[model samples]
Each structure stands twice: as structure tokens, then as C-alpha cells.
Target: MSQSNQQRIWQVVSQIPKGKIASYGQVAAQAGIPQAARLVGNVLRKLPEGSKLPWHRVVNSQRKISFPIGSPAYQEQRQRLLAEGVVFNKETIAINHLAWSS
Candidate 1:
């Protein structure tokens, strides 16, 4: 069930605290779908309006915001993360700083 999988991924993502972030792979693994990291991302990309999921807490393996700067999603994600005290360096959320441990 796509809806179930998306909900599961969101649950795992919600566990990440403010100012912290998880790799999509890490969230997928935590959600019992270790190979579905990209799926997690895809599902998140489909989240509808008013969804309360903390999707901004999920990033790429390199702890970078993979969304392009010109995209609205990219702006929202960056703003949300920054509001949560996440600091970025040279276009990436410094992996050394925000990478949440498994």
C-alpha cells in the first residue's frame, strides 16, 4: 500500500529532532525498508498540501539538500531547516554537523 509506506516513512522521519537530519537511506532502514531510500524520497515528494510530516528532516546520503535552488520545494525545505536551527555551508548541510547517527 503506497499510503501505508508513505506513512511509515513519515513516522521514521518524525523521530529526527530539530536541528538534526537523517539520510533518506537511514530513514528507509528505520522504517523497515532498508532498500527504499529513494522510495522514501519519492513518497515525500508526493506529500499533499497540509501534510504535517516533517519531510524536511530527510536529506541525501551526503547530508545535502538535493532539491534544486530554483524549485519551490527546495526553498521550503531550506527555510524549514533553517527555522529549526539547521546550518548549511556552501550549499550543503555540512554532513559533519547535521548527520544524525543511526
Candidate 2:
């Protein structure tokens, strides 16, 4: 994806409200690339540290964090979600309850 597309993805991600999450596919759709869900992940992974974008709010379609179990990224993502009051059912987030529609 071009830099502009990535920026658009970042802009869309930044708008996700606190306590709500969006699937990677949803972020891609909002960014005007409906089929680029994996691309959304790529863009997020490349985000600079301390970015204002809410990268943790982007989850898989199954409402799970994309990081591997026991990894630092997984732990951090879980921490951020919990801090935002996002409830998880086992390994899956309760996305139906907390998904941001816009």
C-alpha cells in the first residue's frame, strides 16, 4: 500500500472510541480498501512507537489479538484492552458488545 493509504488507515484507527474495538477488516473498509484487512495489520505493525493511533483497538475478525501467546505484543495488547474495559471470553474479545460501528 502507498503511504497515503497507510495514513488513511491510521486516521481511521485513531477514531476508534475508547472502550470499543474494530476488526482489522473493518478498519480496512473504513480506510477505503475493503479487502485489505491484512494490509491493515501491516500498517499497524509499522506504526512508530508512541503513536497517538489506537493500534490495540484493531483485532482479528474472530475478535482476538493478532500477537502470539506469551509475546510482549500480546501482553501489551491484552493490557490495553483490559484497561479499556473490553471483556474477553477466554481468548476472544466480546466484540459484539464493544465493536465500534464507525
RMSD of each: 4.3, 4.5
Please give, for residues 5-45, the per-residue lDDT of candidate 2 as tens digits.
88899889999999999999999999999999999999998
Best of the candidates, TM-score: 2
- What pairs collide in candidate 1? none
Tens digits of lDDT, candidate 1, 1-102: 355777788788878887788899999999889999999989888888888878898889987887986588788888898888887765677533646534
Best by lDDT: 2
Residue 83 displacement (Å), model 1: 0.7
TM-scores vs. true structure, each candidate: 0.82, 0.88
